[model samples]
Target: MVQFSFFVLPLCFLFNSRKIDNENIKTLQNDSFMRYINLESLYLEDNKLTTIHPGTFSGLGNVHWLGLMGNRLQTLDGGGICHDAPSIRWLSLGNNKISTIEPHAFDCLSQLSDLNISLNPLQSMDEDVFEGLDRIKSLYVYTIYYTDFSTAMFDNTTNLDHVYFSKFRYCNFALHVRHCEPNSDGISSLEHLLARGVLRVCVWVIAVLTCTGNTCVMIGRSLMKHENKVHSLFIKNLCASDLVMGVYLIIIGTKDVVYRGIYNRHALEWKESFGCQFTGFLAMLSSEVSVLLLTYMSVERFLCVVFPYRDRRPNVRQAAVVLIAIWLTGFFLAFSPLIGHGLGYFDSFYGNNGVCFPLHLHQPYLRGWEYSAFIFLGVNFTSLLIILSAYTGMFISIQRTRRSIASSFTTYVGQATNGWIPDIQRKNLRTTALSGSMYAWIVIFILPINSAINPILYSLTTRTF
Candidate 1:
């Protein structure tokens, strides 16, 4: 069979380029588009033009706003036909090299409502510079060279309502504050830099080691054979939980190392992003799962030690069900914040550190602290007690049995039939001792090792960097 192929071309829509502001025009006089009578706004900012002809703007009969900001204009001459242009409502001359504006520079801008002449070298403003602007409502004179302007500057226009003088450098001798927000956090950039750098490096190192070591343990367990498959299954489950914790640590470390502090490094929009919240959720989920799994493992080993001959060991299917339950319970614990467990629990910008940390550690967390205390005492503390007491009891029971057997053996040293214990009984005792010791090592070291390194993990998780 032969197949036919057809090609289709997508339709494209075009727009008028003249309607867009042209930033490449260096001189307004040389731009032919200035005569486009339909143009309503002209932006000639960030250019190299040094002079404005009185007739330069006359062709823009319908232009209602003009921007001449960031230009090299040194003076505004009366020859400009800006006075003859149509009703222009706004004009900007900010960030210019202009040092003077002729007496009647804006005498004909009767309809102008907003005037921006900021960042100029005008040492003083004569009332005549704004004589004809009667409808002006907003004036921006920020960062001007004048120490003080004439008091009558606004007397000619009574409609002025908003005047911005932010960073009025000439007014430093007076009691005026120019900028306030950037320094609101109070920590100097140098101090913040040092703090963030040290923290990021530490977190990165911990994350890499934890992730690598736990991954190796998990993979090793998967490939290795176990004499007791049931116990091996539980060990694998525990390692899986640790793997999640390692992944969580890696995410936190990368976020801090790449983003640094939110105060200076990230934009304001970062607070609305999901990066921080997702990292926090993973961290919480992994942490809760690790603890819950450890508790479950301890209980399972405790049962095995306490009931050696009952054949109570769980099968593979039963272990799977139990592991699922453990995971679900961990999910519930980590998701408490979504139900309003504490205010700002999921907000990354709530505290001084600007991170999504536990509410119990932030300010005004009296109730949160109380809740955390209850959980610590009831869950973590109970688990610790069970693990310690169970292992101690197992060892004690073994020691007592050893003593009783030794006494029996001594009493029946010469009796031919009395010294004979079944080979099965000896094997059972040996198996029990080995199993107990294995569990004791895991309970005493494996679980606590993860818990002991928690401070390092949490230090990075709670901080913004």
Candidate 2:
């Protein structure tokens, strides 16, 4: 693999030739130079030649290599080349003005092994451009500069060894080679150098907010001393979930920054591997449980307000049972990938970042009927609708209850001493209602924000008006 990285530079030929004038070079049009003397290698680099005719080298049957670097040619007709040099093995056309390559241009060159066309302004390379060269082991093509290479682009090549990109200099160029295997260290080092400081700040902010917010919610619930033990229990569980999520965010963010920076100096430890798997499982579990808990909270509120005495609320014990059920369901769902697919460590050219999240919904090894894209869309949409509908009903009921209370207070104002109703338990009712309202709003607000963050990052990085 390492040896192939050095073969990007083409061999040079230094020889004396007749001093050809501009008119002669210009007059050499298409199909005019078919009978040149036997040439093993030809060098026409760093020249002003703008065209190569169909039969320019038709008779050069002995030609083994060709160089056309640093030229003004805009296109290369593969049909033109294949007609002449069927035995050509190596070809270099780097640093040219070529923007396109016609398919079947090199169809006749079955034994061709190396091809370099880097540093060109090509917008696309047709897949069919590589149709017949099964023996070709290396390919060097110009890619969208500064973008990370994705493995998907090179999936078709079964035995490809190396790829090179050309970098221009004052009067020359050099090739930068990349192997096909994932280079986890290089990816980790680059990510650490670029994202460490920002990630640290993000982790700090998340940790402080999560810890403070959850602690406040817990304290508020405890202070209320509500009679409804089920409501209090659910509130405690939600706080715990939020606390776990916050800790997860901090740990993941810190690891991403630290490991990337020290990638080359250290091998990943066993504890780190365990942490990766643990964090992934917990993050997935907590996220799912949070969603289910929100749904349950909405249903509970709907029953408390809309049905009142008609719908008997779950007791403290029953609520505890439900919470346990939710956790178990989340655990099984989140860790299913590990149980079914055999979780193992993976390192790619991008570096040792973390444990893999279950393969994105398309791996053949995954059991059961695959969830299609449409199903995911429908499931999320339905969940959102259910939560929204329940909350809307709860809000309307609260408004009506407040109106009724106001009317009653007005009617009893004259009969009450000092305008106070001693028998009415106003404080307890207000506390219960207010707590439920606050919890509902928090769930509604956080769900949308969490879902939007990933999409926002992708858009900001890849899209521009």
TM-score of each: 0.43, 0.48
Cα lDDT tens digits, model 1, 1-465, are: 211111111221221112223344444442233435566676767766677765566546666777878877888764663554646788888998878877767777778898888898885456667777778877777766363454445557666655666321111121112222222211112112213344445444555666666566557657876566665565556556656655655554554445444333342333234554455455556655665665565556445555656776788888889888988877776666445423543332211122333322222232244444444444555655565565555455544544443233222211211111221132224323222222222222233346334333323221211
The C-alpha local distance difference test score for the whole of candidate 2 amounts to: 0.48
Residue-level lDDT tens digits of model 2 in 1-465: 011111232332333121222222321344333344355665656666566666665655666677767767788777556777777778878777787777656667776788878787865555456666656777776442422233334444445566554211100111122252123211122224223354355555655666566666667667766665676677667666666666666665566556665432332341235566576566556556666665676677566666767846688889999999988877776665445433232221111133222212212122222321112233333444566677567667765645443233222211211111211122223223222222222222232223223222212321210
Off by over 4 Å in 2: 1-189, 193-196, 219-224, 260-274, 342-379, 395-399, 403-465
Model 1 regions lying over 4 Å from their true place: 1-197, 265-272, 339-355, 362-371, 400-465
The local distance difference test score of each candidate is: 0.50, 0.48
Clashes of each: 4, 7
